[model samples]
Target: MKKSNEASCHNRVSQQGIKVQLEIIKTEARGWGVRSLNSIPSGSFICAYAGELLEEKEAERRTSNDEYLFDIGNKYSDGSLWGGLSNVMPDAPSSSCGVVEDGGFTIDAVEYGNVGRFVNHSCSPNLYAQNVLYDHEDKRMPHIMLFAAENIPPLQELTYHYNYVIDQVYDSSSNIKKKSCFCGSSECTGRLY
Candidate 1:
């Protein structure tokens, strides 16, 4: 029974891979973005955010800029956090913040990553990130899967909310600096944060 289940899982993964064909393209606003070569149905698996997996401490030390790091932490029912290779209960819920007990593990894609690296951020996005655990029970290192949140047309740029907390900075005059949002959505908040 275990073997049969494993085979079934493998087959499903293979099928998903066949349906996903994406390309990186230069955008007018965002520097680079990933686009679907074919129409993608809602709830379909797009691809995994592949990169170098690092521990919470190591990830923090290496992350000079927050450009390519993806937090994959899990939160237990008790509200405890675990990150990066740490064993987590199978029933634990995945946290969007990726906060761990100490720090948080991150997938650094700046040096090496798949097409997922080119996926730009939007306040209103057609894609959404999902924490999927397969081939392992560790939630701290679960696969960051991208899924189409709605039906996507061919050649449409695939985007998701980065959910980055915008930090307020003050100039010499003590005025707040606002970061501009280029998402171009009707519901754009005018700020990337």
Candidate 2:
């Protein structure tokens, strides 16, 4: 493998002949989204969710009423995943160890992030987040790599499910702040969370 920095290039051609380049563009519905600039094959790495890493507690406190935080807690264990707008719950466990300690953390991309932050949500998305442990063996803070879940054509918007959990609390009127989905896919659930 190439150096960690080189391997994380946002625009480069890999040995597999897949062009890994992405661009951020305004979307008709989702405001802004990430689009491919070249054909990408299934399972090819797209880009890492680069951002400021924060401690679990600090992350929770910061994102309690925010939206740019991505939960990476479950990456430490082998069980079901949680965090983000997905399966996260009030009772989820917390960790204090840093990325090098194999402990949980969150990636806050509100002020500092890469193009990966622009990828929108889709009910039937063509991209997926894969926890990649490159340059470090710690699984808890693995690089959140966006990979093509299927063959992606050039100029196509890359998206993935935000995996927002919909439950009783979500149906309550108090949570009217939930955003709606405009992905336009037949499978569109109509809501972002």
List model 1 lDDT by residue over 16-81, tens digit each.
Answer: 553678888999977989998899887677888889998877865664555777866545332322
Cα RMSDs of all predictions? 6.8, 8.2
lDDT of 2 by residue, 1-193 (tens): 5654555564332222335777889997678888888987876767777789987767756744455777766544433342321321245454432334444788999999888888888888887775656467766676777767788899999997776654421322345446667999998888876
Worst 10-residue stretch by lDDT in candidate 2?
80-89
Candidate 2 Cα outliers beyond 4 Å, as residue runs? 1-19, 75-103, 168-177
Error of 1 at 74 (Å): 3.5
Query: How high is the CA lDDT of each candidate model?
Result: 0.69, 0.67
Give lDDT for model 1.
0.69
